[model samples]
Target chain A: MEPRSSGLVVLVLVCPLAAAVLLQLFGRLDRRLCMPTALAACLASLSLTGVLAGNVARGMPWVYHPGNWGGLGIELKMDLLALLFCLLIAGLASLVLVYSYRFIPHELAPRETSYYTVFLFLVSGLLGLSIAGDLLTFWIFMEVMALSAYVLIAIIDVPHAFESSLRYLFMGALSSLAILLGVVLLYGAAGTLNMAGVLGVVRAGANGQATLALALCSVGFCVKGAQVPVHFWLPGAHSAAVTPISAMHSGLVAKLGFYGFARFIFFVFGTTAAVGVLKMTSVLQWIGALSILYGGIMAILEDDLKLMLAYSTISHIGFMLLGISLLSPAGLTGALFHLLDDGLAKACLFLCAGIFIYRDGTRSIQQLKGIALRTPLTAAAFTLAAFSLVGIPPTSGFVAKWYLVLGTLQARRPFFAAVMIIGAMLAAVYAFRVVFYMFFAPERSGALQMDDVPPAMLAPAAILGAGTWVLGIAAIWILPHIQRFVASLVS
Target chain B: MSQALSYFNLTVAFTVFIAGVYMVATEHNLLRKLMGINLCGAGVLLLAILTGFVRRGQQLADGTVAGTNTVVPAMQWLAVAGIVAITAITAVGLALARSHKRVFGTMDLDEKRNGVKQAPPQSTPNATEDRR
Candidate 1:
């Protein structure tokens, strides 16, 4: 990275933080400026990311060590993968900020100012994590994300929201501790905090300390990912939060876990198949497989619309984890592609679910029946999203699933291939359950009585719904970029 | 005895972490759970200090070398970062517990869940006026 590009990278990471601070100051003067100010910051971030992506398109990653003290301070690395995620987060966040204009209740006026501040702050954390070049910076940004999420969940101020937010706090604290412990161990083994430096050190040779560090790190990340025992917190957290938040949590926050996992395994560890480390990748595969089946089964049983999407998120996370663990080029590419694919689809799905709740004032799956006749556009948007989630052809979801299945075959894991197919089948079962109820179930309560939600809400969902296919159609170009990214990171 | 002395800090840190996890697992009190989380953070904080402790390159009295030391002052910064994180988390956790207590009149999670207290007053009555 040249000086100019590196400087822009810093701005890209700092823009949201700057906007957040500005919002806080202006919040005292007028409360109405919060949304536009946040949106402006997102625009700045998106443009800055465009510059950094231009840099990434040129060559290998360039680490920008702030203060130029030879990396003694925080280092920010820019690359194709980081740029992709930054764009997704910033772009979606802008839309969410816009959606909050009419979507957030006017009663929460006093709270809305602080909401935008924290919301922008959260966006800063996500962008920071995307480009963080070292584990300490990574952990700090992860904390930022987790802390803001806790506040956002509780911001709804209902009793159930409080309960769920507190539980999320407990879980977040535990995960942070776990990751901190791992970082300490890694420092002990490799005397360096920078991830690329860790790779260099580990490649030189890893003893028992390196092995223990790997185990500790994986445990921390799995908790963040919400694979099994730790995953029980997600449904409650998602259900208790509002729609825009639920979309952010499901779309971007969950994908960040896979981002961290890929960073550690492919970049920091260098993918060299260290004798003991190979075993960890295999273990990751097993965890992925288990989560696939578990998330599928759980989603099938969920009666709440939001909770079902939450569980479906976990299952798709399983697919990404499975892709990363496979350690094949095709698998890594699939994982990255799917991260984008699922983010768009799920954001659309959750936003449409928000419209359902808004129109019908209920989240129960049964109560949502006959909603389609009432609001055909939202129902249509949702069905399109479902097709994406179920991996129907012409959506990005199918492209990602196709590559994932091929990656599994490449790794010679036919069983996981079967798991992918079976999981998608289960996804079809649950996704269409909503569709059938919305369109086919007879109207009992005369609920087809209102027009669709206001366009402020519908526009974002429609765009994201279109994004799922746009990404799919553009996959021919996008997949090659992802392949190049995986090659650069792993090598 | 020599081996025990050589690995003392690592063992102590690990032990503290286990104890914290045990507290978290066994305790139902919300404050106690927060304390448990603090204990866990303390254990990790100790480990962070140990990452730098070997930089002085001292030999044990039993003559076992304390391993190579690179004089990484960066590790101390890591410890400082950990402390800041703990402080923020502690503030948030206390705030949450205070809210929990006001709502339920007790610190037990099970009691809160089982409806031992009155349901919270609704924020917007007409928002859900029609829904069952």
Candidate 2:
């Protein structure tokens, strides 16, 4: 299908790009201008993505080819899958930027301008990744996102943060090299970098080179996604970064790996013959199951609240991977739905954790005794996010997991379904443990009396907390559209 | 002869890539690991350029096959971009190492050797005063 020519795609990318460059140039003029500039860029991109989503849903996917070089020029295609993730990236980014308004001033005051600049660059990278139409474009944006993320993770300047960021950088660079190798191999085998062009070649007949490329790319994405065995870098990196950065990492950055997998699995190597030969889906399913179990168990044992959430992120990523690996319509829909739902809930949880740190200056769950009594709204938001994470009913997590279970049944994978349920149970154990500390634990004598966090910080968490419920209640209307999306994807 | 040369290039690329991976996986020094990362990237870039080499022979502007194979200039452009990316990563990694050394007083990654303990959580000013 020829994509409709639309500038909306370019506008979506240019908003953040322009803002990042502008901020780097003028940001030092006044630190106060940085946050608003970043926030405005984020909101502008969000609105543009919203418009692009509307066009895609109503008509065909939008494509923008810069320089009109045809196959040689880079392609930026915004399909249903791309738009879905774009919405999530832009929406969560706006909230995180708002949260950063207060958090940055308090934590890393002097470096605020640079923080906003890098943060906008990060947003641009992610948004670019979403709309990237070819493997080379995807890899370039992947590097952009990874580089900015390393900087953000280390921005705190603490010893632990630096160490963790270094470790993450090493692992990230290794993964990126592997991915580049895969892209080169794929280009050699397929003679093209455009995803559709490669798909045509792959469908005709895949070769050993294509298989090797697939394996390399999958391994690279797995490392980035934090699937178990390669997941060690996550807990440290996620916990050590400043709170808003942690939220972005947990909420959006890690999901990019899964996004890469979905694009390749469903869009390029999607043929039944290719899938059977690769046996990739089943292997991925088992890995997802292991990650689910491992992350959940480790989260339960973690004492640091941020680390616990980080572990839970690994578990949740497993759930989405399992859904995608099912390769069924319901399964894909569930995975995409979980992607949005988890991003919102997890970002909210991290933002709420930021509030605790801002107020109490402690990350240990034990140190959070009776915090709910002091900051009831943030606590309530925390509980709401936890419920969503635990897949409690009336929250979006349940709806996403429901489709996933249905998908497992559809795929006749009863064992994986059981794994999903067990993962949820483990999630509940850790999530409620934190909640139990906050709401029910005995108060420490002479605890400082503090009001709820300033509205700038609290509102972002509250909005995302409410977003979880809104998504859940709206899933009734949303699921049909997702099913349509899945149908389009599979067919 | 050119075919043999391309095969040799492929062999060297894989060898350097594996050697780099080994260095990154086994090296204890932070700088060595960064070097290993660069080596691995260079190997991949070499392989990337190798891909654009016309295996049969060069196609001249007149579309006749030539005696010598020509490298597509596009791959060179890609290699240049890869170099820039690697340079940026190296700069960041070096800065990180410099700071890590300043903070922990060592270049070693070993936690015990560096004696780097996790920083205690920052205590709130009001809470600490209340406790006092």
Clashes of 2: 0
User: In candidate 2, which residue ranges exceed 4 Å CA deviation?
Assistant: A271-274, A443-450, B1-10, B55-69, B111-132
lDDT, residue A24, model 2: 86
Q: Per-prediction DockQ scores?
A: 0.34, 0.34
Clashing pairs in 1: none
DockQ of 1: 0.34
**Candidate 1 on A1-491: residue-level lDDT in tens?**
34233577788878889989997778657767778889999999998887667557665555677887553446888877788889899999988877788778632544787788889888999999889988898888888888888888877656678778888888778878887887887777777788877888887775555676677777777877788756877888887898889999999987766888888877676566332564888888989988888999999999999999999988999999998899877888888889988999898999998888777788899888787878888888898889999999899999999999998998899999999999999999999999999888876446454455788888888888888888889998878778876776555
- Candidate by candidate, in order, the iRMS in Å equals 6.4, 5.4
Assign candidate 2 its CAPRI class: acceptable
lDDT of each residue in B35-108, candidate 1, tens digit only: 99889989998877766665346653234565776335567678888888888887888877766665566678
Candidate 2 on A1-491: residue-level lDDT in tens?
45798878988988988999998889888889998888899899989888777667754789998777553436899998888899999899999998898889999886888899899989999999889888777878888889999999988868899889999999999999888888777776776777887888777775766887788888898999999989989999999999999999999999977898899887766646346667988889998999999999999999999999999999999999999988888888889999999999999999999999999899999998888778888998999999999999899999999889888988999999999999999999999999998888876544545456789998999999999999999999878777887887777
Considering the two chains of model 1, state its CAPRI-style docking category. acceptable
Q: Pick the candidate with the highest TM-score.
A: 2
Worst 10 residues of 2 chain A by lDDT: A443-452
